[model samples]
Target: MWLLLALVLLLVILALEMLRFVRNMRTIPGPLPLPLLGNAHLFLGLTPAEACLRMGELAEKHGDTFGLFLGPSYSVMLFNPRDVERVLSSTQLLTKSEEYSFLGRWLNEGLLVSNGRKWHRRRKIITPAFHFRILEQYVEIFDRQSLRLVEELKLRRSRGHAGVNLGEAIHLCTLDAICETAMGVSLNAQTNVDSEYVQAVKTISMVLHKRMFNILYRFDLTYMLTPLARAEKKALNVLHQFTEKIIVQRREELIRSGKEQEASTKEDVDDVGAKRKMAFLDILLQSTIDERPLNNLDIREEVDTFMFEGHDTTSSALMFFFYNIATHPEAQQKCFEEVMSVVGQDKSTPVTYELLNKLHYVDLCVKETLRMYPSVPLLGRKVLEDCEINGKLIPAGTNIGISPLYLGRREELFSEPNSFKPERFDVVTTAEKLNPYAYIPFSAGPRNCIGQKFAMLEIKAIVANVLRHYAVDFVGDTSKPPVLIAELILRTKDPLMFKLRERVY
Candidate 1:
């Protein structure tokens, strides 16, 4: 009798759940979902970008948009370029999701993570910091870093190593650039190369990225009992301490010097990327939202957030650019020809903004590279209010995953899309399927990356400097499709190795 009663009770619970599931299933188009789990399990083991791509494939398989339940957290995956444009650009439909509790803790309320009125205001304030004229003023900063990198390569050339870790070199250069430009102090990361601050920054970012997808982490209650949560908090502490020291010291130094303007010489970048009339921190320090100055904590979070954002994305981009150039001889040769022809033979002669812009092929190459391996693989925007997408009734409190990673690889979007062919991006062919949102490497929206100008300039400078010194040669099968681990950005599980041969032209 007891056994029978237990079975009956279980059946009753199952039946009630089934009824609720059926009722909830009325609105969206998706595969038959298992009780409790939903379609979210389909993303297991995949990077968020790859998971997003899988969702697109499923959408094409099933048609248009689909419903996924991340355990109980419901989200609608938007794959159509038109739909993506609406959600990403429109303030009406969606807002930045606060998935990472720790990120909110670490980044505070900076532009990348902030939303609504605050995001709008902060984005406007930070906009002036990245203007074209201001970037042109930042040219020497790019120059100094490139020079330091070349000088380092020369050291390796003299020592006769198979190849220096270009990824490591680029990392240091961008770190120094970010520190000086954003934090207002030169870490001299390019020369020191192994500073604890540098190591801590990378660790914190990697940890932070790891934390993004972790579901159990979302519950505030579970975090208190979890070992991973404790370690994450500890890691955050290290990163906070690192950036705080830089911020406090730099602010003091600036106040003492009494120089608070961008009216200085290129000599400002003592380490590299110098001559900025402003430390990026100073601008943000003086930044006001509705005329209220940012507090110390607010300022620290913004600066720490920007430092990681400014450095990692740009450096990883350059690393992939080298990997692609090394693998594709014809493409690399074309890029080399363009760089050589326009601004050639001398590393000391700075690459100007006009000349960098003129290197359309290089631009296309970076675009192509990013499409294949996007720096930020996935973006999540949660619905601020109840909305309709593709005429489907999407409820409030739903997360929407908008991924360029999937959009770039669609067979319908580009002919032979999986192939690494920068040539496809040439003017005539590109105009045929001209949805501007289809190829959103930096993303397409009002909330697009603020430092896009600075990133590109630095990348172009590095490529020009690199090609001028050495002709890249792959040590092994650089053609093999790399396994990219997409966390905050898509990065390789292994080093993209090569044998560097000095070009004596």
Candidate 2:
């Protein structure tokens, strides 16, 4: 009788809580959700691309702002620029949503996932690593890796393939560049794309994506029971071991050279081959927060974070850029001509930061590519306190999603939003001013990407080198575009195919 009375009381409390949640969310227009399941059934077993499309369909059916229950979590997605600005611009709304917790195993409390005081401190420590002088030195690494990419593509074509998936090639190249720049070591991912380290990264990413959508796999206890958990564990071991090894090796090297002290005080350091550059690892190894030097674990988290963000996002941008320019021959010819004229006709010539800056037309095309396929399709934040966004009361504890993918395609924001028109970003010549919040490929406001300049420089280097060597053309049916999936970073369901012909100067 006592146990039965306790069970009844627990049930009553749950009912009251559910009723309060319903009262708060019902005012927000959205699809009528099923009890307990909420709107999860709509996304059940859907691919990331299909799920993204479903969200888009819902946005069209409802208005700019809508609500949904993702498992037990109530989320409100904001599409309008006003609502986006309110959330992104606020200092208090900096905490990442619960979904980011899934990355905790791989990234830990790095700059990407940390919040409040910790985020602020980490951000400060990492800021100097991207100093203009430091980024300028990384241009050499970009030039070298991008040339390697061109060589790899040529070698593949010589092997008698009619067309190759240019995306895979780009991925390997970016991975190589990031490893060198982030950790002061080379995985030679371009050469060994099938290495254990590479495969581990891929596996972890796949597992994380599936876990986000699968309700049963969301909890730690239940997730560990599944087969994916084993794969994830193996991958984590490989990744953690790799990063920890690099961190130890880098720290030891720095200490041995006695330049470790210099790195802490100065923005630059003497790297291998007499190159004056500081890899992010060097800075972290020497950095002190509150007068205490960062330990190995802290350093590894940031280095791992840098490795993931620095490579994948830039690789995504390049892949889509290649696809877009290949499909538009006029744009391709213009970009090629710009590279040849500004950087020189010699395909072997190294592209300098100055030359990359001179390729104004290519810059326009890169911006346009990001606009069409922003590397990060969705930006999410958890509301810490009750807030009013565009006259709507957004209750605390609500997960807020802002989709750059859909935001960039709004008819009101861009005329013919679907077309690949580089001229649209010609701010100097065009009279129509763009709303800053509407097109946030790199995002905007306080939590914007810190490595945007580094990414831009690397992208331009690839464009200059690749276009200097070959004339690229998309191989697939133009009408049937590759299915896009947003897995942390945006990617196609399959690698994008392209034909690369050596340019006759």
Candidate 3:
């Protein structure tokens, strides 16, 4: 009789839980979810590339805004620009969603993941590092790296105009450029493609993507038992050690040169007789918040954040730009003409800040590419307070997802949204009157990407340099789009191939 009573009590508890779930489901429209698992079954075993496609399909069926449960977490996907702005523009919703906690082991409380007071403090300290004057100093590094990339392409073409994976090559070039500009260290990653640090960065990104989609890996105890976790541990060691070494070396160098004291007072500019300007790391070393200087850990976290954000996102954008320009011959030619006009037909001439600014047509192409394929397809925030979107009440603590990827493709916003038309960005056209929140490839409002200007400059420098030295041609079917995956950034499931023909003056 006692055993029968215990069984009855268990059933009562489960019935109550089911009743609560049903009541919550009535408020939102989405696919019916299975108990306990929620919608995890739909995404299980799907690659990031496959997952993005699946999400798009669901969006088509469920409309612009829908709700789903990812293992008890109520998530609302916002594809409408107005809905996205409602969440992103809120000061109360500034905290990143729980999914970002996965990155805390690597990024810590860096500018990308921190919230509230910590975020404000770091943002204030780091904003000066990207000032126009400081970015001008970075232009030389961008030019040098671009030249190296062009040289690499030339060497490859000398053998034959064989199809080359420009995506991988551009990633290496960007990695090298960011390392030099952000850390004041030459990784030579463009030449040394198989470096350990490069491999570690790649490994960490893959592991993170895997953990994100696999619910089984979301729990700490379960994840720690997996082989992927072991690999992640090793990769973190490599990444942390690399950044820590750079931080220590930079600090020691400042102290040895007796510039440590001077750094705190002097303007962040190149020293009188120095050949190289101070890097982003140098600025961090001198920065303080609340009269307290940043410690070594703080310095490493920021450096790591900058290195990853600075390289990966820009490389992804450039990959899509290459694909767009290569497929659109007219646009490609127009960009080439604009580049040649700015640089005066000298392939060896370095790209200067002023010269980069003049490549107006090339900038349009980059912007168009970003519109079609934003590097960061989704941004997430935790709703800290109850909010209303499209007349629907979004309860506090709900996870809100904003997709720039979907917003950019809305027919109501852009005519021929699927087409690669650089002219859509012309200042004289109606595109100039479009809503600012509508075309937020770099996001919008207060929490937008701080490195957007730096990214654009780097992209323009490389694109101009490449077009001046080589005529890129598509090697595959131009009619079909590449299969895109939502990793930490946007990526292609397969290699994006292109043919580079040596340009004749």
Q: Which candidate is the best by TM-score?
A: 2
lDDT against true structure, model 1: 0.72
Q: Give Cα distance to truth, residue 481, candidate 2, Å.
A: 3.5
Candidate 3 Cα misplacement greater than 4 A, ranges: 1-21, 158-162, 265-276
Stretches of candidate 1 exceeding 4 Å from the true structure: 1-24, 39-60, 100-102, 154-164, 191-193, 253-276, 428-431
Tell me the spans in candidate 2 whose CA falls farther than 4 Å from its real position.
Answer: 1-21, 266-275
Go through the candidates in order and give the C-alpha RMSD of each one to the true structure: 5.7, 3.2, 3.9
lDDT of 2 by residue, 1-505 (tens): 8657755664464455445457766667877766666678898888888987999999999999998876657789999998898888888899999898998999999888999999999998788788766887789999999998988998888774769888888989999999999888889998897899999989988898878767778766558778999999999999999989988888888788987666554433323213666677877887888878899889888988898888889999999999999999999999998898997777778888788889899999999999889999988999888888878888888889999989888989988899999998998886657789998988887888989999999999998999988999998889866798876789988778889888897
48-139 per-residue lDDT for model 3 (tens digits): 78888889888999888787777536788888878877777777778888788888888898988999998988998888888777888899
Candidate 3's TM-score reads: 0.93
The lDDT ranking, best first, is 2, 3, 1
lDDT of 1 by residue, 82-140 (tens): 88887878867536765644577678777778777877877877776776666775666
* Backbone clashes under 3 angstroms, per model: 3, 0, 0
TM-score of each: 0.85, 0.94, 0.93
User: Which numbered prediction scores highest in lDDT against the true structure?
Assistant: 2
lDDT of each: 0.72, 0.85, 0.84
Q: Determine the C-alpha RMSD for candidate 3 after optimal superposition of all C-alphas.
A: 3.9
Tell me which residue pairs clash in candidate 1.
141-273, 262-277, 269-274
